[model samples]
Target chain A: MSCLDTIADYGLRSIGIGERVLPRGDGIGLCEQFTLIGSGLIWNVYFGALALLFGFVFATALALAKASPRAALRKPAEWFVFVFRGSPLFIQFFVTYEALVLLPQGGLHLGGLTIPTGWVTSAWSGALFVLFLNTSAYAAEIFYGALRAVPKGDLEAADAYGLTGWARFRRVVWPTMLRLAWPAYTNEAIFLFHATTLVFFSSFPAYQQRGDALYYAKYFADKTFDPFIPYPIAAFYFVLVTLTIIGIFGVINRRLNRHLPQAARPRLRIRPQLIR
Target chain B: MFLSCADPSALSGLNWLICYLTTDKQLMFYGSFLVVLLLLVVVAPVALAFGFGGALAARSGFWPLRMLGKTYTAMVRGIPDVIFFLFVPIALDQGLEYMRHKVLCPDWTAPIRQGNDFLVCPAAKLPPTDASPFYQESYGFVLAVIAFAIVFGAFAANVISGAMNAVPRAQLETAEAYGMTPGQVRRRVLIPQMWTYALPGLSNLWMILIKATPLLYMLGIEDIVYWARELGATKSKIYAYPHPDWRLWYFLGLLVFYLLLTRVSEVVLKRLSARLARGQATMAGEALRKVGA
Candidate 1:
């Protein structure tokens, strides 16, 4: 078959859209590797994008709860963040997969509603859930730090204007917190993308041979006994994706800091440790 | 092992539980935890040393050595480190055998690469191809450690180089003005001061190193993950334990172990950070000063 035929066959293979079976043996090459791995990028995007969007709101609440004077609210948020952040993501994956398996084999039933527990075994569901909690804890920590660093003058201004409670927080406190936390949040975003590679590598089975980029790369490496080729292709793809993420976040960062003078705007330096 | 727990098949209730927990294989499963810890303690310093040498060489006056060091450091940056974890052991093994083949069988003349096979002289074979299982296992573990050290060392070099730059130029200038040589200044002042700046990066790297330990399973080492899978699988009635699939519980136990490790490290590191902050000129030190006031 032609290269286009191969692409057509495996292009959406990750989501079970096209080919029913994976190509075997020397069937792998630059074309097959690029096409299939790119297909698997769908899962990565789905997990990263959705987890980030949802984690944003949850993290904000977590930050607020952590900063609250009420011990009931503050303590739970603190422990949640501590437990998630303190552990390695790899362990989290194993624990999650096993937990999902232990759930009643059939679908869960509640109040006459049948909830789908089958998909929980998937990388899309299982790994995404883990990544969601993991990022929430990390982002909550970042937001908490930013909340602490909200300038004393800003709070004083809110007090002087008699703007108490939600009014004060919405107008003054939240925006500044966002500005301070934006850079670290961007780091969290990149790390989430990198962490997506762990999805298939963990216990979550890549059903119907639908695996991520690293999975396909490893597949080729094992088959060809040549690590030099497929791995660099995967790396090149990741670097491109990483750079794209940086570019998009950099734009949001610009808008967030638009009120500042040109020199005062923070530059996004690539911090290596920013990714767990 | 409890002596009363001998009859695993006949026993029931808590007695059966005690017998199941004390099986010889279960003991080996527990032993893997120590192996993981040993790998971490052994690998971290070796990686740091490699990183130090790499960073120093990259900054060297000699052009070739500088290029080599720069390339070594940059090599790991572009690729997913998992690639290196998979590739390094095999590549190193083959590379060593190739060198030995070239040296030991100088009189023999044949291409080493023939189809899928990598042929080497019998004298050059690693573990002699008939070595004890212990030799084979130890050799594999050593190779894995070297691979981790090489990859993580590059990351450490990046951190160290930045930290070296973060140390104020004024300190070096003043040391020179005091009639100190470059080497002497580096040894006495720069090295001592650079650590305070490097501490944050180094600590972060240490955590990453801990997380990366799970990749040891991929390296063919029988790590905790391997044992978890082996011990946690469903056991049939024919077996002594005869338990349902408890792999999930085993994994949960592993998760808690990691969480505890990280929690303890955070507490210890916090104390270390406080110790490092003493009389230092930084934002944290400034906060400490205000607290004292």
Candidate 2:
């Protein structure tokens, strides 16, 4: 088949759309590999974007809780961040997957209504849940650090302006914390996306062989025994996504620092989380 | 391990638990934890050495070496490391085998790529076709270590090179003015001073390396994750010790293992950083000096 035909066939293949069966063996052309892998990237974007979005709010709460002086609030938050940050995401995926899988196969029944538990075991939700918690922990730690690092002068200024409690937090504390954390938060965001690749590699099985970009890349490589093409293709796509993430976050970072003089603004440096 | 462990079915309470824990597979599970420890022990220094070389190369006056070092850091930084973890071993294996194929089987007719399969000559197979199981296992492990080192080394190079730069250029100039050679300046001043800056990054890298050890399971090493799945799966009535799925517990144990490891590392690293900071010109050193005074 022509390259365009191949694209038409497998373009949405990773989502169980387009082709039912993947092209096999040496007969699989680069076009099919590229199209299917790119299709698989939809899941990566889905997991990463959703997790980062939700995790952002959760992390902010967690950071606040951790920063709180009350032992009741602080202890749990500290332990949560420590446990999640200390362990590898790889094992977290397995542990979470196993726990989810062991849940009642039938949906949970509350009175007449049923809440589905089965989907919680699948990669779409299950893996996403794990990623959500994982990113929240890492980001919470980053935010907590930033919250601590927020200048003493900034807080005094807020107090002097008669801002207190919620007003103080919303107007002064939160913004300063975010501004301080923005660079590292950007790094965490990139790390989360890169980490989305591990979902399929984890215990959560891809339903119907539909998986993320790395999964499809592994599929092509296994079939072809040629690591050269599929991996670089996956890497290329990831690099593209990473660059886009940098661009968007860079804009936010600039906005965060807009109040500061250009010379005083901290530049956005993409620190490798090699932590992944 | 206890004498009473022979009759597991007749046992109960902690007695049965003791018997179950001492099973052969459980022994292997315990062994795999050490495998992780071994990887950390070996890979830390190996990766640091690789980083040292890459950092020095980046600082080299030569343009080509500088480009190579810069590219190493940039390339590894951009892509998810899981790709390298997956890519390097097979690529290296294939590359190694192909070299052997060229050297040992010059007259071989078959193309190495046969449809979807890799067709290496039999003689070129790593550990040889008839090698012992021990050798084969170790060979796979060595490849995993190399892969980890190559990827982490690039990150380390970034840390180390940045640390090198963070050491004041004036210090090197003073060393030169004192008639010390470039090599002597690097040894006495630059390398020693860089540690305070490099420690935090290296400590973070150490934790990451600890976390990444579980990826060995993906590379087909029968690691803790492998053993957890195997032993924790439903073990119908046919076995000596029957049990329903207990993977949640097994994985929790693994998580605890990692938590403890990370905690210990954090404590040690904090001490190390303090030690490195003492008697230096930084804020930490100043505070330490005040305490001493």
Candidate 3:
């Protein structure tokens, strides 16, 4: 078949479009491999984007709570970050899935209403939750560092301007903290995107084998017994996604540092050395 | 295991739990934690050596060696490590077997890649078919360790190379003024001074290494994850320990184990970092001097 035809059939295969069944047996051509794996990128984007969206707010709150003087608020936040960051994300997925599986089957009933808990065992909700928590912990640590590093002069300026409490935080401290944290948070986002690949491999089964990019890539590699093609294709897709993340984060980073002199603005450089 | 543990059906309550936890498989499950530590102990120094070589090569005057080192360090940047975890072991195994095929079974007529199959002479098979299970497991394990070493080595190389660059240029110049050769300067000045900078990154790598131990299950090593799943599955009445799925508990135990490992390592690393920072011409060193005075 032509490459275009393969794309037409398998392009949305990961999301249960075009093809109901994946390509099997012989004639697992390059086009099919590319199309299906590209299709799988949809899930990776889904897991990453949703987790990141939710994780950001929670992480900000966590950072604030951790930085708070109140021990009651601070201790729980500290422990949350510690527990999440202390363990392997792989273990988190396994533990979360297993725990979710043990939850009362079917749905929780309140009066006439039934809130389904079964979906929590699925990769979509379960793995996303794990990813969200994991990213929050890492990002919180970064933000906490940034929170601490927010200049004393900035706080003094806020006080001098009679900007008290929440006004002071919103006007001065929060912006400075965000500016300081942006680079590290960008790194966290990239890592989180990379981490989406782990979802299918973990305890949560990829229903009907509709999985992320790495899953399809693994499928092709297993079938062909050739690691060269599919793996690189997956890596290519990841690199593209990672660069896109950097680009998007870079734009936001610029806005954060826009008030500062051009030379003083911290450029978003991808620090590849740190892998959590 | 206790002598009474043989009659698992008779046991109940705490005794039943004890018997279940003390099963022969559970013993192996506990032993697998050691395998993880062993991987860390073995891989850290090996990876450090690989990283050291890579840093040296990257710093080399020769173009080809420098290019090779740069590539090695840069390779891990784009890709998720799980890909390497999955790819490296199979690739290394095949590469080894293929080499054995070429050298040991030169007379073999058939192509190694016959359609989808990777055919090799029986003699070329790693831990050949007739080999003992222990040898086969060991072979699999060694391959897993190598995979870890290769990936982590690249990370270490990045850290080491950065640390090497962070060393004060003045120190190297002083060594040169003292009539030391480049090699002597590198050995005497560059390497020692680089450690304080390298310690933070290396310590972080050690924590990551701890977390990555669970991926050993994916390599089919029967590591902690594998044992948790195996032991925690719902057991029928026909089995000695009849129970619903206890995987949640098993995994919880694994989580606590990792948390403790990370916690202990953090303490140790913090102390090590402080120790390394002493007498260095840096903020930490200056702070230490102030405290001492």
True contacts kept of each: 0.39, 0.77, 0.61
For residue B183, model 1's alpha carbon misses the true position, in angstroms, by 2.7
* Candidate 2 collision pairs: none
The docking quality of candidate 2, as DockQ, is: 0.79
Error of 1 at A209 (Å): 0.3
lDDT, each prediction? 0.83, 0.91, 0.90
Docking class of predicted structure 2: medium
DockQ numbers for every candidate?
0.43, 0.79, 0.68
* Per-prediction TM-score: 0.92, 0.98, 0.98
Relative to the unseen true structure, what is the C-alpha lDDT of residue B230 in candidate 3, on a scale of 0 to 100?
92
Residues A1-276, model 3: lDDT tens digits: 889988998898888778677887677888888899999999999999999999999999999999999999999999999999999999999999988887789788889999998778999899999999999999999999999999999999899999998899898999999999998899889888988998998988988889999999999889889888898899889889988998999999999888889899899866553345
lDDT of 2 by residue, B15-103 (tens): 88889999888999999999999999999999999999999889988999999988887877679999998999989999999999999
Per-candidate RMSD, Å? 2.6, 1.3, 1.3
**Local lDDT at B173 for model 1:** 94
Q: In angstroms, give how far residue B246 of model 2 lies from its true place.
A: 0.5
Off by over 4 Å in 3: A273-275
Candidate 2 — what's its lDDT? 0.91
